[model samples]
Target chain A: MASSKDVIHSKLWQEESEPGDPFTATACYCSGYDVYGELLHKASYVDYLYLLFRRERPLPHVARALEILTIALGNPGPRDPSVHAAMSAGVGGSPAAAALMAALAAGAGSSGGAREVLLAMEVWTRCGCDLNAWQTAIASPPVATRQLVWPDIDHFPGFSPYARDVSIPVRQTLEALADCLPDGCARWLLDHRQAIENLVGLSLAMPGVAAAALIDMGITPEAGEMLTLLLRLPGAAAHALEQGEMGFRRFPFFSLDISNDPGPAMPKEGTAR
Target chain B: MNERPPLETFEGSLNTTMGGCFPGERAVFRGHDLHAELSDSDWIDLYVFGITGRRHTPSQLKVLHAIWVNTSYPDPRLWNNRVAALAGSARSTGILGISAALATSEAAIYGRQIDIAIADFLVRARRAIESGRPLSEVVGEELRTRRSIGGYGRPVAKSAADERNAVVLAIAKKEDLVGGGYLKLAFEIEEFLLSGRWRMRMNYAAIAAALALDIGFSPREYYLYLLPAFLAGMPPCFIEASTRPEQATFPLRCSSLIYEGPARRAW
Candidate 1:
């Protein structure tokens, strides 16, 4: 007998009944909740998303806060590299999933990326809302770990040194989310928003804000990373799909500095090079 | 509904000295004709140029090519390649299969992360050396933190030796490309390990990173350039698995899963 080489384990999820019977799932439990039978009609999608990670249905305010942040991060638009990655696949007629994969890969870095959110969430774990602690940590950032492929944080992951002025939407979203979850870290972030912004010479980017929101919700950094990626996905998916139909002609191609090779110097036919 | 982002949010023309398409006319890549002038150029040359904006000599390009070639392990049991095989097994689109495979290539224990770690270690080592820190002390600090250096150890079931290192270094030697700063330091670390308590040999990624550092790939550039290093092996895995049967890529019997967690119960 060949001994079992791999074993699948999960406390977060399980499904009863095999597929292809009249009722494929007799029941599906998510962290002990009867997902389809009991919680299907009762729970909101955000609540369900919360249960998937946090393993419990959230309080109403927490659900609302997640929804607010979700709406804020839904679509980062075309110029955002994550969205642009998806659009590249769309324009090139590549497979649909490539666009999102491109988004995830491009968004894995520090500049408004998921890893930045992960780092920010880790920061939240270290220093909750203490201005002095934030300052000390920022001034003497820890040496980056070697296990990850992402680059070292040049600036604090949450704060962007390049942002000149805090934009309207970022501030609005922060205030809205903070209002919803007043007792959580979001409020702490809200209270100290300007002070930290002044200290860093700029406000929190979306990832930083999202990190604070996740922390306030009692979400772990690991869970926060997933949520940040999940929340930001709407834009990447929507733009990639839209760009897929627009094709390359109607899009911005050499609008500046028109050249011979939209690929100008074709060798009668393009061969390999 | 939400308000639009500020006008100057990502302002500035998306200009590039890199590549751009002219639509129907021609494509520009690093100030050269994509088709007309550089049609005879090897693909790897064009790729390396795209990364660093500097053309490499044929000798350099050959070693770079070998670095990619030796990594084309078609076995589906490997982590990243399994995604491709499974994608094909499910009859998924090539784009999804390849993209998912590439995405999963950012492994913690191996692959691109290892390259990134090696490059980063080399950089930090150089800086510490420049700042008058002894080489051994820096290595000691890193070893103490990370347990072992990133590219020096492997999951040595059969032998601790890295088989691919010989082939790649041979190409580097054949091309007279062995003499590079980071490469020398990489070997020094390996030598240090050999003499010390942790007797680990240099793996392929360590040398590749050293060569990349010598060949003038800034850590970020090297990171970008090596993103698709395992790309060549994916498509074949996808095709082979897909052509066979649905759900047939390495079929495990249902009983193969030994769930040690909780007993099956109703929700």
Candidate 2:
């Protein structure tokens, strides 16, 4: 019953840690140990989760506490010197170690594993970790494909998925990695015409790499439709929309002209309701 | 253990059951018809509290489709024939019909009503989004036409009152809720409304299973709350409306790690 803010402030989320450790606190705001378990579970939780990128035994809960700190410091992916240094500090890699490695990798920049972090964030939303960090981490200049230890941004054009400073990297990561996403990544580059049209017309505007990546993929026929609409609108209106000040009034007229009946798209047929 | 005798076996079926206004007249299935009427999505928003309007299995979806196709009625008994067949099927198939009937027939009935009454009002809003229409035009049109159904009507956490209820609305209010997180919200809401919560409703044992899709509860971990919730609360209102005490009191028990406790609702 506590407000999200109150719940966030509760002791349930507190984790004492060493000064230089990476942050591993559960972002969903579940019990502390459980969050560690989710990151290191032997089953699909570990295998599929972006956090456990490498194979290892679970880290001591104490060391894992660094995850919260590290993430707070800025999403440390595999490339992050600090995260790699933390991984090296562990004696024998445990599941927690593996999760730290993966979490680090996800932040390492536009890697598929990074996308997996987005998925983990979505699944573990209750944790209430800071999301903005994840966006910044994922948006960090990506590493290219050939050198790819995992799927990094350098490999995927315009593929930044998380918005910097949104919430917690864990939350954003999970949402990005949700089930039934395109190309197995939470945010995919639209590489298709219809999709691009949707974006241009502003029918399809997602956040982060998903939006930019989609545009990078290619301008599709859908993009053309959206472009057509944008062009037809008064120049001021188009600028307003681009400036994030667009409203929702003329949608029906444009839709009606484009499709005659905004039937399926409108939800209710015959009229706009 | 609240198992009760079936309504048909009850000495006075009509005496035990209360008839509310039929679909098309009032909101019967809690907020199903109302929610569907408001949006153009393919899915129905079902609010199943206890055993009365529980989740439907795959086969039950078919039965629900059957009942929905069967009739539009003021008499609740109109569902009896369908329910009897469903109960008989459940004996073998292990999935009941009542849930399906309620989900489909009731959704269709109410969706039509709300859509009919509010279609014009929605058009201008849609146009505004599509055509890059001025905010003034959209608001003015909605106001001039007296078409705004202002209250989001969904109960949210009291603390988060300033937060918009729906992702679409949040998108419209992009400045207040900027960035990828906004898209993430939309995706989460869409998933909850379409699949995850929908499946949870079908399983019927989770605490979240008893609540509406729009109502937020941690999905998997919420099982810890089921037993206590059932023990503390009344059965779903619709079940109380149609079935007898004996039949209505189906004991809520499961071998899974069930947590018997109070369900936290935003309302």
Candidate 3:
């Protein structure tokens, strides 16, 4: 079974700097999908490509976009699900992604229509994928090992559970985007940063601390400090902290003294040199 | 595409609903249902018949207006997309309902006039947005002009909330008494129309709009306004209203006294 980390890396880790056009980006994302082989990390990549293409055209092109998607997915890979830990989550082609691609392809005939396609592609892709989902997963801790399976061509599965389970890397990616995209098309990404992060963290299979680090980076340092505090709590509080279920707690992080060392002093009002 | 009904179907239906037409191809009248005549005064009546209480939100009313403007005239798809964009923005931003039906319904109304009217009603219920006057005031005033021709009375509520809820509740009750498959079908037709795609080798909206004009609004209005009410009654499941049941409550809301059925039996 492919792990979440492998899935994400396969779809998004290509070394290419920027996709020249919608077709190339889509092609890049589906670089690992092959009909006869095990499903590759094509989930996000294919989804990303559709997102790009969708910005440029109407949804009618989805069938065609998907055709291109399948073609690209069908071409690459050694096809071993075991090589990728990322393959653990969602194994299916995203319906929303397919819808987007079909809409794009249906608009202008699939040739020389890059400019319009590119313009439209920018609208949906500007925010990147929803990230809060990843973060939520990462802030959560691990449990028993289980068999991981990728979704088949027709169905995409394993989204919700994975999002709540994984935490770290997902948060990192979200932080990276929030840090980078705030001024442009990415502003929307921040709105659902929590959800996106939760999805990403789970999809990527990162540690809980990694998620905390990401939240710290994307939001405030104080939030990071609080998460760090939660990690040290005893019994269910600590467990809940690791699970990203800090909602039901009875006390504040400030009240708990996890570490034996004294914490950083609070800044006084109007301090001078 | 070459063999579509003329715009006259809509106009003719409007004429019949307002006055003479004994259940002809384009008219259906219930009682002295003068609601059709209100169109002459540039007013449209909203028949809400169900729940004793619920009301239409300002935003819902605003969205309705946008839907009506885009659907009521030619190029309903164009308006549908624009309204969908607006509605999508509001929904994604966490400002309104998060379900697909309302969004789909709002989007579907673009090319079809009755759908447009419902959307217009939604838009009208909103407090004045961007524009200075509230949409409800605008629609209500316009509706008043139709009162002499159509015979629609004002709701009993003095407050906006009371009036809006009365409308919503009325529509809900009517929908519960009758099945709401027609509204669902209308929603589907609108989606196909706004999609601007030709499917089954046909541009669905043109077909839908023509049919809408032929069957007209009185039937559609009752069906649409009552949709929310029906949905509330039933639990969630995929709705296959158009295909499963061959017989439908044609103009379920409107009476045969005003308009007729399809101009061509094909529909």
Best by DockQ: 1
Error in Å for residue B49 of model 3: 9.1
The single-chain TM-score for chain B of candidate 3 is 0.18
Q: How should the candidates be ordered by DockQ, best one leading? A: 1, 2, 3
Scored by lDDT, the top model is 1
lDDT of 3 by residue, B1-267 (tens): 113344454432122212233233222222222334222321122233111112343333433333233323221123223232333433222112112333334322222233334323323322233357643344446446532101111122211222232333244344341123333333343343335332111122222222222222342453354333212211111122222233221111111122221121110
* Regions of candidate 2 where Cα sits further than 4 Å from its true position: A1-165, A169-273, B1-88, B92-96, B106-267
Question: lDDT for model 3, on a 0 to 1 scale?
Answer: 0.28
The 0-to-1 C-alpha lDDT of every candidate, in the order given, reads 0.78, 0.28, 0.28
lDDT digits (tens) for residues B1-267 of candidate 2: 113343355333223121122334332232234333433332221321212333433332332222222222323333322443333333311122333333232121222222222222233344455578754455445445543322111122222322212322332234332233322322333334335222211111111121211222222212222212211111132334344443332221111112222232110
What is candidate 2's CA lDDT for residue A267? 39
Native contacts retained per candidate?
0.26, 0.00, 0.00
Give chain A TM for each model in order. Answer: 0.87, 0.18, 0.20
Could you list the CA RMSD of all candidates, in the order they appear?
Answer: 5.3, 28.1, 27.5
Model 1 Cα lDDT, one tens digit per residue, A79-142: 8888888898788987777778788777767778888888888888888878888888777765
Candidate 2 lDDT score at position B38: 31
Worst 10 residues of 2 chain A by lDDT: A253-262
> Which window of 10 residues has the lowest lDDT sum in candidate 1 chain A?
A258-267
Per-residue lDDT value at A192 in model 3: 53
Q: Write the per-residue lDDT of candidate 3 for residues A1-273, one digit (tens) a residue.
A: 223332222221222223343212222212322311222332334343433333221132333333332332221121211111111111222223222222222221111122112221322232234344334433442221110010111101111222344345444443444443344323344455445434433232212222222232232233322322222222222222322332324322222222222212232467541
